[model samples]
Target: MKRTQNEKILQIQNHTLVVGIDVGKDSHYARAFDNRGIELAKLLRFSNTAQGYEALDEWMRMIMEQKAKTEAIVGFEPTGHYWFTLGDHLQGKGHRLGIVNPFHVKCTRELDDNSPTKNDRKDPKTIAMLVKDGRFRDVYIPADLYSELREAVSERERLQGQLIALSNQIHRWLDIRFPEFITVFKDWGGKTAQATLKNFPTPARVMAAGAAGVLQVWQKHLQRSSLKKAERLVRAAEKSIGRTAGSEAAEAALANLLAQYDMIAGQRQRIEQLMQELLLRVPNAGKLLEIRGIGMVTAAVIISEIGDIRRFQDPRQILKMAGLSLKENSSGKHRGKTTINKRGRRRLREGLFQVMIPMLAINAEFRAMHQKNLTRLVNPLNKMQSVIALCGKLVRVIYAILTKGCLYDAEKMTNDMKRSMKAA
Candidate 1:
């Protein structure tokens, strides 16, 4: 549940103890403070292990008993994945966990001592003070299927990055050794192209093998041989201006790159398969996939990033989480330009933007909306603005479908837009 700042501040009563922890890769430092920002105990140092967590819990209980505090709220900067274990530990122990923005901690560090220097001891106090002032957000830890979905999506992204890096390296290798290779086969990853590269990568090798040799290599993998393609490759090799030195080293490099590309490609395929399985486990995810432009991967990613749609009161919250919420800079009577805040999950925002492109092509309702945004009589948004607006619309649609258990209704969507236009 989302809480107002006042409500959050009220939660930190006199009997409540706020503990701020500075998370690290090896060791963590924590300090306890009363509701009024007074230190309750000395700084506690703990290792990043089970025993260390037990010691920290013991220390917190001691502080609570000594200071006459009834409840304890632990707050900390996320500090990457290091805090995940601690957050789960605290939550499991029945302590309320609050996540303070690392940026807030950095900005507010000078508030107490007015010193720019940083250390383990000074950060916990700043985190605790932020929690006291209600400058923290409730942490959302995915459980069950949501946890599996998140992990699967993360693995897919990692494999995607590896695939891209391997692709770039392969392209660079081809550019140096077989510059004209791309002209023959636009994508070297194709079966025939890959087989040819695996067998005869260099122009010298291509010349030695000739067209028949290349065709022999390709025929082993390809169902049908293209003599014209083979002849073209041979011609390009003959006129090639590729490097002649370091032939042995270049062969090894190309072999290694191709092997890495194949391995990463297989890994990505497996990850997508896993993502598909996990998406089935998520409730109402199939309804999202029913939309024309929303593929399995896109739906899985959106569901993974925004777990448990019931937590959000409205679609606007989802938009804000994606950093698609609009911001303005108006002051006094002067109207100012508005733009997206871009302060939330970057991957989510990118996924939304990418999904819009296919949506504009495949989804009639979305295409109509895009066209209306472009050709409207008054203050028509540009192409990019239209896409951004559509992204928000898509978020609302997904939220409604998931929360209300309704399927996509094209006519209803169009009618709603018409009513909105009339209201405007």
Candidate 2:
């Protein structure tokens, strides 16, 4: 549930004990405080294990019992994956958890002692104070299908990064060994190109194999014959300016690169297949795929990043999460321009931005919106701004579709825009 600052502050009363934990890789430091920002107990040091979690829980219970508090709220910095296990443990143990931004912790460290010195002991008190003042955000841990989807998406991204690195390495290898290889095959990822690279990577190897040999190698993998393409490859190899000194090492290197590329490619394909299956478990995810430009991958990425759309009270929250919400810098006579915060999930923001190009080209409603944003009568947005605005609009559309279980409605969207413009 969403809460205002006052409401959040109200959650901490005299009977409530606030615990702040500075999470770490192995051991964590924690401090206990009451609603009045007074220290209630000595700092507790615990390890990142079941026993450590039990010790921390016991310490909190002891503090609460001693201070005559009935409820407890645990706040900590979401410091990478280190906090996940602790968060899950605390939530499983029925303690309410809140996440304090690491940036906020850094910025607010001077509030108490006015010193910039950072220690494990000093951080927990700051976190607890932020929770007391309602400056912390409630943490949302994805569970069940959402958890599976998040893992799948993360795995896909990791595989993609590996694939890119392998491709770059192969490109570097080709540049050094067979400079003309790319000229014959525009993309080395093609079946014929991959087959040729795997079987005969060097220009000398290709020349030795001859055109017919390369074509036979391709035929083993591909159904159709590319005789003309094979001829071009052989001709390019015959007059290639590639290095000839280290033929043996070059061949071995290319072979290893091809093997790694193939493995990563196969893994990516399998991960994508798994992601498609996982998408089916999400409620109303298919509605997103029903849109013209929104594919299964984009829908899966959005759903994975956003988790349950119901957790958001409105589309604005999703917009904020994507960091697409506008921020203004205006004061008195000196009014500055407004821009996006860019403080949210970067991958989610990138996905939204990337999906917009195809969406603008394919979806008439989105195309019209983009054009209007560019040429509207009052305060037209630039191309980039229009794209960002469309990204937010896409978030709203996805949120509404997921929450309401409705299909994309171009006419209704146009009508709503018209009503908004008229009201403006």
Candidate 3:
């Protein structure tokens, strides 16, 4: 956790070789500089292959030998998945890698030539200079179980997006083809509703099938079939005001969506199992589940995003990483409302907020803390504000549980507010 600029600058001493790279999908550009920010070699362009990594290694070796530099510190913008392989290769070769923020690069690119001209050749130099000035963060490439968990979470997120899209499509189909379908069954994805949709898609079809026919379809999946519900479905179909045109094509579209929905549903279940299995393997990760409202998926997501909590020396880093840390916007005489920066991992932030809301609903300790934040005499927070404040507190509790292997203590989490009030 060498967080400060001085600590970072201290790492880049006289004998250190600072190499900056501009990473791309198929190619990368590299520029070398010393601690003094002096260019030591011409830019080297290479492919995104093993041979290219070796070539970059050789180039760095040649520069080190000529410039009397011993260790290499490589810096680059983490421009998506393009940098992961390169970062892994560089680190595996015994070189330390640093990630300069793209925003920082954009801001600093004009410092040298007073022009914001971004290119492969220009970015490497900009990246290198940033590294030389100690304006980069050390890279933490997760290994083994952490990697598996991260991939599992990412796959789950993708499947979740697809499922949402398919769900929306299904809703649209129901609205157009069978508007009254939702009135009978609140959830269209339910077993009974899905069976009805598969057997009778259109209002005309439902009317022709009759209530007995709808009950027959339901019995195939469920042990019990409701004739009364089926009769209601029949009545709605008879009184339906749904479109009759495009019925065939609409059925086909809904069939495709239903198929996709089933496939994605299966995939989501499988990925969740894998995520939980991977989560169990992580040391002390199960401690997170000890909390009242947190579940396997929530614990897995937090663990995956944090990627080995030992890397974080402080819980504040965790808050900042999750974008839960608040900042005040102000000028000399004018001030603005303080809010969370939201500049870190979006998944981490979203997961924390989502879990916190439910935690407030189900977990007594979190709810108490949230209530205190809202009703406290000084600087009381509103409902949503209290919820956001609790999110940061949850970050600390998670950090401690994973790093310290601590058990969940409602007393500590709520800070014994009852005692404080009594004492007062």
| CA RMSD per model (angstroms) | 1.5, 1.6, 1.4
Ranking by lDDT: 1, 3, 2
The estimated TM-scores of all candidates read 0.96, 0.96, 0.97
Candidate achieving the largest TM-score = 3
lDDT of 1 by residue, 9-97 (tens): 98899999999999999999999999889998899999999999999999999999998988899999888899999999999999999
Stretches off by above 4 angstroms in model 1 are: 422-424
Q: Compared with the true structure, what per-residue lDDT tens digits does model 2 show for residues 76-168?
A: 988889999999998998889998888999999999899998999999999999999998778889979998998998999999999899889
- Give the lDDT of residue 407 in candidate 2: 90
lDDT of 3 by residue, 145-239 (tens): 89899999999999999999999988887888789999999999888988888889999999999998889888888998899999999999999
lDDT of each: 0.91, 0.88, 0.89
Off by over 4 Å in 2: 418-424
Question: What is the C-alpha local distance difference test score of candidate 2?
Answer: 0.88
Residue pair clashes in candidate 2: none
Worst ten-residue run, lDDT, model 3?
Answer: 413-422
